[model samples]
Target: MMSDAYNNLAIEFCGIKSPNPFWLASAPPTDKAYNVIRAFEAGWGGVVWKTLGEDPPAVNVSSRYSAIYGKNREVIGFNNIELITDRSLEQNLREITAVKEAWPDRAIVVSLMLPCEEHYWADILPKVEATGADGIELNFGCPHGMPERGMGAAVGQVPDYVRMVTAWCKQHSKLPVIVKLTPNITDIRHPARAAHQGGADAVSLINTINSITSIDLDRMVALPTVGSSSTHGGYCGTAVKPIALNMVAEIARDPETRGLPISGIGGIGNWRDAAEFIVLGAGCVQVCTAAMLHGFRIVEEMKDGLSRWMDAQGYRTIEDFRGKAVPNTTDWKYLDMNYKVIAQINQQDCIGCGRCYVACEDTSHQAIARLVDEASGKRTYQVIQEECVGCNLCEITCPVQNCITMMPQQTGKPYMNWTQDPRNPRAEKVPTAA
Candidate 1:
């Protein structure tokens, strides 16, 4: 029997076929021909080439990275102020030709961002098509550097600019045009709608957000040090997944851009993240920071794992239920108001480290208490019940494995008439009049 993961996997990005719905996002590593070709050889379904732009006539700074890690030392968030590729346009084109020739089956998308003028886009669009590449993606989403040069996020932040530039590409090129939008804008739907209005074949996001890494206590420098200084860079990684998914859903759920093809990008490191993007209505998922951190070989795992998961769930292909999870999602207001639970402490397995208790008392509801017994000389903790409010902080803060758990409370209680959860009190039964 095919695993649930693999049984259902098909990707059609702008008429390009993908064995799976995952693609590599444009970034530094995927910027050059060598890395991209290596990625293709490693089983990636498609690649959105690094953002190619009109020569800035400037060189980028060295060492650009900002990271936020969880307690386990795993990097949960990342930021980078990387500029476009420093390589010459001809060098990129030459490699594009060779890579596409070798991997004709894989989708090759060239990400381009040039001056906003019609001539600049018109000049590059046709040359990009001649590369034998499958399509062109307008890079309106870079959060830094390029935007200052009158491209990237500068174009994306304005609806008119988005529409005008995308239309220019559509007019100048026969190849499909995918508009990549920045996540920094207030309303993502506007840019997505603008892309559609401009006659774009599809829209992809989010091209990172403007970010400030950290300031050096002594030297007053930000992260990804460029000789004791830094500027706002793009923020990404698993930390940004929630934000990306929400933006994609907004576009998917919007009346105007609901049908707009979405290539989801951000924090997509593994198959599960990719699958989540799919079920939320993204046409395909893209990776950048993940590939940069783990290497192109990670694609092997992403494909196999996603395929296995689909087969296990009885999905025969990607289309079997790509957006199956989106409909069930709802706003907080629509959530059931009666749901309640209290955290349970597993005493038998409890290590008594008190991490949960400290966390609860200090930052959360004072829902837990530690007790001491002189007879046994041992100590343990218990939930205070009335104060829990079911926030699950104790569970998250617990040191031992599964030491703290949450159990749903009995329903049909008298409704609490708070502002957030309005009063829906049950009517008292009364004797019927004869």
Candidate 2:
């Protein structure tokens, strides 16, 4: 009952095949079988059930969510003080098994977070494996609530712990293990390398950041205030996309972890976000905040949009464009220093708003010139090519689209990097390109 146009969206990540690359993340959205079943009905390819722990599960606070809103009151970033599943382990396992059996075509990845003991992992792995779920994503990334108990980021922030627990899971279970990484660490590469060393099947990231969205000035406390106080919660949504992309790229290009499958997470709200993650080396992508904001039906847009894009790009399969951008993602030191670009103003499209002039003159390079016609009392703004650094600040601040553009200059100078520049104190002794 599926169209051939979307056939290319299918992907097999770490041996778990799905109808498409979109999966609901292990969050409140996938907390129950009912929610997950609805998501599947809405065309989501898979779901990583909400993170589970041993019975007598995590008791969450009443006011668990806080959000930072955009000008239009849309949630730019979401924060949650809620802990893992508060339901009994037995109940969660039963639902997972039933869901898997019912929707055999959809991928069901169970997310787990237990104590960092080998015996604990040894005890739980088989119980989850018996459910016939497609995979297990180790929840080592929760930044709040659990970390204080030495379970989430407390374990993920340490490389040895990541490797040891991952090893234990591999030893105890036949299912693929995906180590969900915490972005709270200093360098994301360490834990990714640790997962690889411990023989993980794949890795997913970046878990919510530790943050406080805002404070109630009236109460004089952080948001989602419980009584007189509030604690920092996990921060997610569109605000974290840039950070997620960089971390995904880091693991993708690292020699120690190259070729290791990645299930990208963080701020992936639309098909474009999913495509960006794939191009940077994620085999699949997970979504949470977007679903919470827009409901399960959002996946329909994601699926249709991604399929259309793939068709237009002539990419027959996800693998065709996966990691295609990794080679081009490089260090700034390797960038061409001789490349020159300047801002150009299209007077015809300019509304004479003078926003570009004010922005550049006040804060940036003062690269824009404002001219007034005395006879007509009309204002015009132009880019001073000599002063423009091609920072694009003017263009970004401009209200009218296409009014300002950054035009590259053919400087005739050969490609030169910072390492080869004479201005560098420790310049490499390499011949310049002719």
Candidate 3:
């Protein structure tokens, strides 16, 4: 449990307040009242209820999940072919109203999906508002089943459609509107900008990416194979964290969308992941795959860890550090051309595993040298600094912690970028920053 003295996790995102930053995303983990109640009991700050559509509801396929595993058989990536809530609208609304009434302090933002029509938005917005939920997240990012029906990613991929739909929802409902953006698009900024222009209060992202996890060789069909045929599903889990972070940074730093509230959702499994998103400008974060994999109790660790970290960092609130990393995130062309780092092996810590040597010699630059003792036949590895590109491959491949480290070289040259480098043909095109 987070101590009351340092309980700084509370956040108010686009007018929706949550006791903590962790919220269950609108996936299977938040499908119904039963699951949502358990999540709240487990200490989740909130939940975006599984996407609700018009009745008669959307039906999902059985055997809807497939996964890519790490060497230890851990689920590194997850795929799902499931669609929106299959339950009727009336039932979902009743339960939503009950749960919100029961736990008024917690956020209960409803995730909604409807056809690209003004009448549909106008009809359903009032019904959802009557539930007394905190807000509504437009389901524009489901990349799998819903797209085939001209919903989900189909509407999300088009900026015009996103703006129009968002405008319709805002016009129809008084509740705060959050447009969920799809990751399948070439540039995420376009849809995000459109959502902002259409009067969205915030945006949650990186809804599942399109993917096919694996194929059953014998059946010649994708895993989670159904009746001998299978289709691509949305990919998620820890493997997508890097991609998610990059996209979040893109939107956070974009001049047009700057200061737009973001609810980051992609491969967020722990406190560190959530903290990274927060520093990169996410006001709050949503979780799905992590809860599905480890159950709802994981929020306990997430909350505790984040609280402890914040205390150590002298941050009293999430806002203190939010968007701190956005300015540091920039294009590679702006990187210092003269800056350099080289690998240095700590002989005392080195176990002589030679993993670093083998990795650098074979795959990366041949920067590590293997030395053999004449009498004892003992082996030692040393870094050849001249050849080291400071790519950190050797440091990454080493099994022993702190065995290989990258040390920055004291290059006397002033900060210079590719734009000012004399070697570049277009060096004169842009003025160098003073």
Candidate 4:
């Protein structure tokens, strides 16, 4: 039985114990008491409550959300112009207290955004603390609508502001403080280092990239158009996973913020995505766009899939594979320049598709040859090894999986990479006898 496996997936993040590492990100899915209770019932281990600010919350438009569809009409990307929770601060706090009281086992971290003023943070800190939530996530990452009010990315883009605000939260709140970072800045490390310097217990990222999903060419208006006007909102979903992973790795591997715990958030929709983030050094992962698309019940699949995969891989717990991939991530200069591989085709499994041949001949290196067999008058394809650069283009173009494989060339050359290659101008030289 999958349940019979002795895999311990529970995690302690920022001093809060979660039944699992899957937490609903502070988006629409975790905005209300009903949503959070449903999420917990759906098997989610935790949730970061929707961003809260001072009372008299910001107004929202009728059509505040838009989506980017794939060729099959799947929501590959999502965009939202919605601001923080539009409910009264007291109502939100009351609900948080009630929910936390009802489900004390589940992690409840409230997401907060206010002016960067210390007093503003001070004023709200005690109210949130009174709720008995697990922690506080500083909303330094919302890309749109909130920044104009001097919150959200406005405070995040500035490292000094991030540090100051984080310090203020830490000073006022006894709960663990996590700084949710914005990805808009040039170097993500600056804010990450700043969060660390400010004594953040953990850092969650990336909030969202500033994006204009699409424009109606005929109308000349952007999407989620309200009265033919729209502004760039936050973009999330599968499309942002790579960006989020890179940022997480940047923080995990940086010397300054090396040991800082990360709560990975970006385009995470399934168990594999969550596992990838965990392996990349995220103690937990936050899901928004996926949950928004598929609903809360998807956590059942995420939990089951992760548990089964971990059992099969002999991982006794989440920590077994957590951050294991970090060491493998290195600079491009360290790549082995002498490594070589040649494409080989399995004639039986080729399916006679000309995709590989056409792709290689037209768009990629011309390395595949189409020939005819005289015996049965059948067409056969082969790889021209000499011209094949092992680019994997032919393999990727092949419709049939495993029909094309790259066979590594056995080169006697030592593992010398671009950084040490004599051809490189910046390569270090070994001293020679005069």
Lowest lDDT sum, 10 consecutive residues, model 1, at 1-10
**Pairs clashing in candidate 4?**
237-267
What digit string (tens of lDDT, one per residue) describes model 2 on residues 14-115?
A: 999999999999999999999998888888999999999987899988889999999989999999999999999999999999999889989999999999
Residue-wise lDDT of candidate 3 within 1-434, one digit each (tens)? 32223269999999998899999999998989999999988899999999999999998888899999999889999999999999999999999999999988789999999999899999999999999999999999999888989999999999999999999999999999999999999999999999999999999989999999988888899978889799999999999999899989999999999999999999999999999999999999999999999999999999999999999999999999999999999999889999999999999998998899889889988988999999999999999988999999988998988888899999999888898888988885656489
Candidate 2 segments whose C-alpha is farther than 4 A from its true place: 1-5, 432-434
Which digits, one per residue and each the tens of the lDDT, describe model 4 over residues 229-283? 8899999999999999999999999999998999999999889999999999999
Q: Which of 1 and 4 is ahead in TM-score?
A: 4
What would the TM-score be for candidate 2 when compared with the true structure? 0.98
lDDT over C-alpha atoms for residue 120 of model 2: 86
Clashing pairs in 3: none
- Which sequence of candidate numbers ranks them by TM-score, best first? 2, 3, 4, 1
Q: Report residue 201 deviation for candidate 3 (angstroms).
A: 0.7
Sliding window of 10 residues with minimal summed lDDT for model 3: 1-10
Top candidate by TM-score = 2
Global lDDT of each candidate: 0.82, 0.94, 0.93, 0.91
Candidate 4: segments with Cα more than 4 A from true spot: 1-7, 374-377, 430-434
| TM-score of each model, in listed order | 0.88, 0.98, 0.97, 0.96
